[model samples]
Target: MGHLKDMVGANVAELVVVRHGETTWNATDRLQGQAESDLTEEGVKQAQAVASRLAKTAKHISAVYSSDLRRASETARIIADAIGCPNVTEMESLRERHLGNLQGLARAEAHLVEPEAFKASISSDPDESIPGGGESLNQLHLRSKHALENIARNHLGQRVVVISHGAVLRALYVHAKGCQPAGRVRNTSINVFRISASNDWSLSLWGDVNHLQGTNLLRASQRGDEMR
Candidate 1:
């Protein structure tokens, strides 16, 4: 889709979104939920790659925001350095879906271990609660929309960089495009969107991983039924 490109100030304010780099839990094929975790060695490198690239292409990124998770925060910090911004402010509302009791289980393990409950959770409607306990799709919808609106209100006329989890970023895309929330969000990939003076949003790209280039970009959940 063509993204909106009008400038509100002397320049247009684009939302440059990057998924947080990978993590030790990710390497172990574990569900990180909203639990805090550190970036893997490769994840750090991936963030650096993104930061390096942004340093070259993106200009006038006046503010940075990130999920409160350590992985996302750390990645945002790297990008901030590249852009010469001080640090990213943490936004808890931008955090990933709270996976509840499935915090550390592999998708396969969770399914086999609690097949009925797992199925119920995944298939839960927007209003229904996830069986094992967690944020429902509807809850995420509310929080993400609120966070973006707040950002747009406060940072009206400047490019902003946001470092967030894969699923959370995907949720933003789905919300902006009015699509069913099933799109893939590659780790450390970038998605671009823009907001207008009238407060409309446009999705420029989604789940892109060109920066990862030659690395194996697979997620443990992708090997399960999560792939679309």
Candidate 2:
């Protein structure tokens, strides 16, 4: 771990949050939810690009944490190698929101099959659950917040990187910023947050994909299973 306690004072921690690279589901416009998918070739490049960017930009990254999902873990591994970090701590709490029956459906198919359920799943209602089995947005918020709080507390005065899914990242963004994120989170995009000694959080960056410029891997349809 690379501690920056001396440089950053003992009370503050900077958390760098990254969404995993695109998976085959993402390319095909399918919902992955808790279901798993392998990263596409472009996804691998995106991960590598972001990893290189972080290695060049971040002064000190004490730890790397990732959702245990294969997509996220793979991205974290690439980044860990780029940053010379030895290991990544995997946390199930950081996984994507479970979409239940909507897990593998394409967006259009989901709407066609169960419009009402789809609407509810995408709605802002924190308590609304997707049909079948899965977590509500409110439930997601709680777990995401709890996971982030724990990480911040444990790594105070250090810089840590967290690799997670889109929905989970949105939940955390709303928790920190008190507003829905402005747009879709691109694959391997970086979001920066500052955690005060008291654990109060502030967002400094969100959905930044400048590192992916010229990669030609950006997706056209922002609508996806995990995001909706």
Among all candidates shown, the one with the greatest TM-score? 2
| Total backbone collisions for each predicted model | 0, 1
Candidate 1 residue runs with Cα over 4 Å from true position: 1-12, 181-183, 215-228
Model 2 steric clash pairs: 31-225
Q: Tell me the spans in candidate 2 whose CA falls farther than 4 Å from its real position.
A: 1-6, 219-225
Q: In lDDT terms, how accurate is model 1?
A: 0.72
User: Model 2: what TM-score?
Assistant: 0.92
> Per-residue lDDT of 76-189 in model 1, one digit per residue for the tens?
999999889987899999898876666667765887876655665586477765566777778877888778767766777777888887667767877789876455566777
Per residue, candidate 2 scores C-alpha lDDT tens digits across 1-228 of: 222233554787788999998888998888888899999888898899889888888867999999999999999999999999999999999999988777888876988876766877888777998887878999889999999989988988888999998988898889889988877877888888878778788987888887776647655224352654
What TM-score do all the candidates reach, one by one? 0.86, 0.92
